[model samples]
Target: MGAQVFRAFRNFNLENRAEREISKMKPSPAPRHPSTHSLLGEQLRHHPEIKGEIASKNDKLLALLKDVYVDSKDPVTPVQVKDAETRQEPKEFRLPVGHHFDMMDIKNIPKGKISIVEALTLLNNHKLYPETWTAKKIAQEYHLELNDVNSLLKYFVTFEVKIFPPEDKKAIQSK
Candidate 1:
C-alpha cells in the first residue's frame, strides 16, 4: 500500500512538472508587415486628426503623380542626369519650435540641480510623454523660472526642435 501511495505522488509531481514546462513554452505572435499604411493604421487608432492629415497628404501625392505620369507628354527626366548637374544646396536642419532640449551632452547632467543647458539636453535626449509635461512642465521640473524656460524654448525654436502644446494628443500618437 505504501509503495502504491509513493508511485501516485511521483506521478502527480511529474504531471505538475510537465504542466509547468508547457506553460513556459508560450508561442510568439506572428510578425506583422512593415508598411506606411500599417504604421498609419496603428497611429490613426489614437489620433484621428493625424489620419485625416495623412489622407490629405496621400491625395496630394496621388494628384501630383497623376499630373507627372498621366497628363505630361514630356520625356522622363533621368535621376542620374539630375544628380550629376544638381548643385549641392545647404539646407539647415532646424529643431521643432518650443523645443528647449539639446540632444548632445544631455546624459551628462546630474539628476538634481542641473544647469539650464544640461536640463535642455536631457529634454532632447529623452522621449517625453507630452501629457505629463510640456516645455513649461520641463522647466518646472528643473526648478527653472518661467521666464528662463521661455527664453530657453525660444533658443530651441531657432534650432527647430518642433515643440507642441502638452494637450496635443494627435502629435503624440503620430510620433
Candidate 2:
C-alpha cells in the first residue's frame, strides 16, 4: 500500500515538472536557404565590375587555347633512352674469391673500413703472429681506428678445433 502511494506521487510530480519545462522553452526558427537568384544579385551588387572583367579574361584564355591548336607543324621526335643498368656504374667490381686479402683487390675499396676478406686475414695474422700483427700495426695498415682495432682483437677470434682420442681407445664406451 505504501509503495503504491509513493509511486503515484512520484509520477504526478514528474508530469508537472515536465509540463513546466515545456512551457519555459521557446520554439526555435527553422533554417531557410536563400535562393540562387537572390544570392547572385547580392554578389553583383557588392562587385558590379567583376563579372565583365572575368568575361574578358575568359575570352582571352579561349583565344590562347585556339592558337595552341593551330600551331603544330613541327615534327615530334621520340627520345632514345639508354638502359638503366648500362648507364649506372657497378657497385662492386670484384667479388671476394678466398679468405686472403690482396692489396690490389682493395684498389676500389673505401677508406677507414676493411672488407670481410681483409678482416679474416688480419685475424689469421694476429693469431699466427701476434708480435707482427699488433693492434697498432693492424690499425695503421688497415686505416682503422686504434680503439676499434683493440676492441676487434679483444672480442673477435678465429675458432680452432682440437680433437683427442678417448683415454682408453680399446674400450668402445666408458661407464
Candidate 3:
C-alpha cells in the first residue's frame, strides 16, 4: 500500500478566515418592536385608591421585616444543655416486676426465630463444642427450622475484623 501524506493544519488560519468573512458581511439593522400598552399602569391610573393601599401594605411589610432582622455583629448564645436530674423520664410500657424471662430460652419468641442473646449463646456453644451443638441439635433445642439453623451457622459470625486501607499509600515514612 502507498503511504498517504495528510496535513491536518495545512491551512490553519481559522480565526483569520472567520474575521475576514465577518468584515465582508454588513451588520443587520436592530429589530423594530411595536409599542405595547401596560395593563398594570392602566389599572393603577384608573384606580388611585389601589395604588395607595399597595404602598401602605409594602411599607408595613418593610417595617415588620426590619423588626425581625438580626444584626451580624450581635453575639449568638450557645444552647443550654439540660441536666440529667432535671430531664423528664420517658413514659413507655415496661414488663411487670414479677414477670419471669429467660435469656437463653425462646419461650415468647415467634416460631423459627431467635433473639440476639439466644443466637449468641447458640453460636458460642457451637464454636466451643461443634460435635455437641451441631445444626440439627441447635435447631431442635431452639425450636427453629433445620435449614435456618444451617444458614445461620454457615454465614453468621460472632464478630468480623476488617483491616481498612491506609489513608496514605505509605502509612509510615521512615526518616
Candidate 4:
C-alpha cells in the first residue's frame, strides 16, 4: 500500500478509497479459531492441536535433558521439578501448630526422669499453650521446681528450637 493511502486508512475520514475498501469488506463470520464470544465473530482458523504437539515435544526434550543431567549426577546435584506444590514458601507454625507429631506422646510422658523429647515438649507447650503451660502450672503439674522448667527452655535452644516470644516476633517484624 502507498504510504499516503496507508496513513489515510489509519485516519477518520471515509472519503478515501481505503475507507471504501474497508466499508466494502464483508462482516466476519463465526470464528473457527477462538470461537468468538463462545461462537460469535469472523476468525482466521489455525490448528490448535499444533500447540499441544509443540508442548509434547517440549516435554520430551526436557525429559531427555533431565536424563542426561541424571547420568552426570556424580558431579552435579540432581535437578528438582518445582511447581506451586513443590516450591511453596516455607512457613513457620510455632509449637502448638505443627502437623506431624502425636499429642498422646506429649501427654503420656514415661515414668522416669523426663526424657529429652518430654523436655522439648514441656518447653514447647509452655510457649505454645500458655494457659496450660504457665511457669507455676507446668512446675506444679510436672512436680518440678520453677528453676528446672527454666533450664529446659535453655536446653532446647541447643537443639535448634529458637523460641521467640510473640512480643519479640512482633518487634523483629516491625524493624
Candidate 5:
C-alpha cells in the first residue's frame, strides 16, 4: 500500500512538471502598435501592396506640394522691396524655383545597359530625343524607386537640362 501511494505521488509530480514545461514553451503575445500621437509608426518589410500604395500616395503628395510651392517655368525673381521711405525692406525674398527642362532638348541614349541617371546624362549630352523616353519610363524599365527617379529629374532641371553638368566649384581641384 505504501509503494502504491509512492507511485501515485510520483505520477502527480511528473504531471505538474509537464504542465510547467508547456507553460514555459508558450510564446508571448506581440506588443501592440502605438498610436500616432505617441510616435511615428515603424517601417515594416512585409505587406508589399500596402507599401506600394503608401509610396504612390507620397508621390502624389509631393507632386501637389511642388505644384503649389514651386513654378519651374518663368520663375519670378525677387527684387529689393522699397518701403514708403524709399528704404529696402528685409522682407524681400525669392521663391525657390527649378528651371523648366524641355524634354525634347534632352539627348537620346544608345541602346545599352547603364544606370538610369547615367543614361539620362548621356541623353542630355547627345541631345537625342526619343519619342517616349522619360525618367518615369526609365525607372519603370529598371525597376527603380520612383523617388530616386524624381530626384534625378529635379537635378536634370536644376542643371538647365544641358548636356554638361554644372562644375562643382566647391570640389578641391589639384593644381
Candidate 6:
C-alpha cells in the first residue's frame, strides 16, 4: 500500500511541473517580413487610404519647396533714403519726384562717359515716379541713346547683374 502511494505522488509531482513549464513559455512574436501587412496596421490606424494619401502629399510638398526656395547667387541691396533738402537733380537727367540719383557727378565719370556701374547706380536710386521704369524710360531719363543703354545692359550682364533673363530680353528689345 505504501509503495502504491509513493508512485502516485511522484506522478502527481511530474504533472504539476509540466503544467508550470507550459504556463511560463511565452508565445512566439508575430513573424516580421515585408510581405506581411500586420506591422503597417499601427501606422495606418487613422488613415484608411494611407499609401495613396502619403504619395500625393509628398508630391505637393516637393513642389511647394521648389517654388519657395529659388536658387539665386546675387546679393540683395538695401534701399537708401536721402534728405529731401539735400537732393540735387542731375543736369543731363531729369530726376523723377521722390527719386534721387546715386553717384550723379558726371565730372567724376572715369572716362568722361558714364560707366555701366554708374548707369545701374542711377537706375537703382532713381525715384521711380510710377514705381517702375521701362527700358525706354530709363534710357531717356539718363540722357542715354537706346544703343548706349543696350550696351550698358550687356555690361551689366557680364558683371553678373541680378536681372532675370526675360527682363534682359525686354531691355535689349527696347533698344
TM for every model, in the order presented, reads 0.21, 0.38, 0.32, 0.25, 0.20, 0.23
Residues 1-175, candidate 6: write the lDDT tens digits: 9999999988877978998999896989887886566668766876768877766657777888878956777654443333544576664424332234543443333222455555656555443342465556656655567776665554543233465557446555443
lDDT (0 to 1) per candidate: 0.61, 0.76, 0.70, 0.58, 0.53, 0.58
Error of 1 at 34 (Å): 99
Error of 2 at 55 (Å): 26
lDDT of 1 by residue, 76-159 (tens): 579867897998876433322233555454433333345555555645643345455566776656655677665665565323
**Clashes by residue pair, model 5:** 107-123, 107-127, 107-128, 108-128
How displaced is residue 87 in candidate 3, in Å? Answer: 47
Which of the two candidates, 5 or 6, achieves a greater lDDT against the reference? 6
Model 2: how far residue 56 lies from native, Å: 27
Model 4 alpha-carbon drift over 4 Å, by segment? 1-112, 158-175
Clash count, candidate 6: 1
Error of 4 at 31 (Å): 99
Give each prediction's root-mean-square deviation over alpha carbons.
Answer: 28.8, 16.4, 19.2, 23.2, 30.8, 32.4
Candidate 6 is scored at a TM of 0.23
**Candidate order (TM-score):** 2, 3, 4, 6, 1, 5
| Candidate 5: residue 127 lDDT (0-100) | 42
Off by over 4 Å in 1: 1-113, 125-129, 157-175
Candidate 2, residues 2-83, lDDT tens digits: the string is 9999989888879789989988969889755678768888999999997887676577878888788555566644433335
Which candidate, 1 or 4, has the higher TM-score?
Answer: 4
Q: Which model, 2 or 5, shows the larger TM-score?
A: 2
TM-score of candidate 1 relative to the true fold: 0.21
- Model 5 misplaced regions, further than 4 Å: 1-117, 120-127, 157-175
